[model samples]
Target: MTNEPIIPTRKLLLVCGCLLGLTALTVVAYYVDLGVFHTPVALGIAGVKAVLILLYFMQLRYSSGMTRAVIIVGLLWLGLLLAGTMDDALTRGWLNVGAP
Candidate 1:
C-alpha cells in the first residue's frame, strides 16, 4: 500500500464547519419559496455539499486520475438518466392519454 498522508485536523474541522453551514442553508432554503427556481436552488446547494463530502470525507481529492474519471463518468451517466426521467415526467401531461 502507498504511504498516504493523513488529512490535517484543522482542515477536517473547517470542512465540518462548512458542511454544517451548508446544512443550515439547505434548511433555510426549504422555508423560502423561490417559485420556479426553488428546486434548482436546493439542488445546487446539495451538489455543493456532495462535492465537499466527496473531496474531503471520501478523500477523492487525493485519489488517482482513474478514480476521478470513473466518478465523473458515473455522475454523468446518472445525470443523463435523471434528465431522461425528467423529460418523460414533464411530457406526460402532454400525452393526452385520458383515463378510461
Candidate 2:
C-alpha cells in the first residue's frame, strides 16, 4: 500500500480529535480521584495515546513491511526497558506511591 493518505480529511480530523481528547482526558484524569487504581488508569490512557501516535500520525497503519517490523521491534524494546525500570523502581523505592 502506498503511503498516501487513504482519507486525508478524516485522518487529519482524527489526529486532531485524538489530541484534543487526550488533553481533555488528562485534565479530567488529574481531577478524578482513582484511589488505588490511579497509576493504572493514567498508564492506560498514556498507552492509548502512544498507540494513536504510532498507528495514525506515524502512519504505521499504511507502512511497508520492514517499517512495520521495525516499529514492532522498537515497541518490544521499549516494553523491555519499561519493565526493567519499573522493576528497579518498585524494588528500590520506599516512597509512598499511593494516595493517603
For model 1, give the RMSD to the true fold: 2.5
Cα RMSD, each candidate:
2.5, 5.7
The pairs that clash in candidate 1 are none
lDDT of 1 by residue, 1-100 (tens): 7655778989999999999999999899899988999999889999999999999989988888999999999999999999998888777778676522
Q: What would the TM-scores of all predictions be?
A: 0.80, 0.69
Backbone clashes for every candidate come to 0, 0
Model 2's alpha-carbon lDDT is: 0.80
In candidate 2, list every pair of residues with a backbone clash: none
Which tens-of-lDDT digit does each residue in 1-100 have in candidate 2? Answer: 6656574878768887987898789779978888998888888888888888887877777778998888789889999999998887776646666523
Off by over 4 Å in 2: 1-5, 85-100
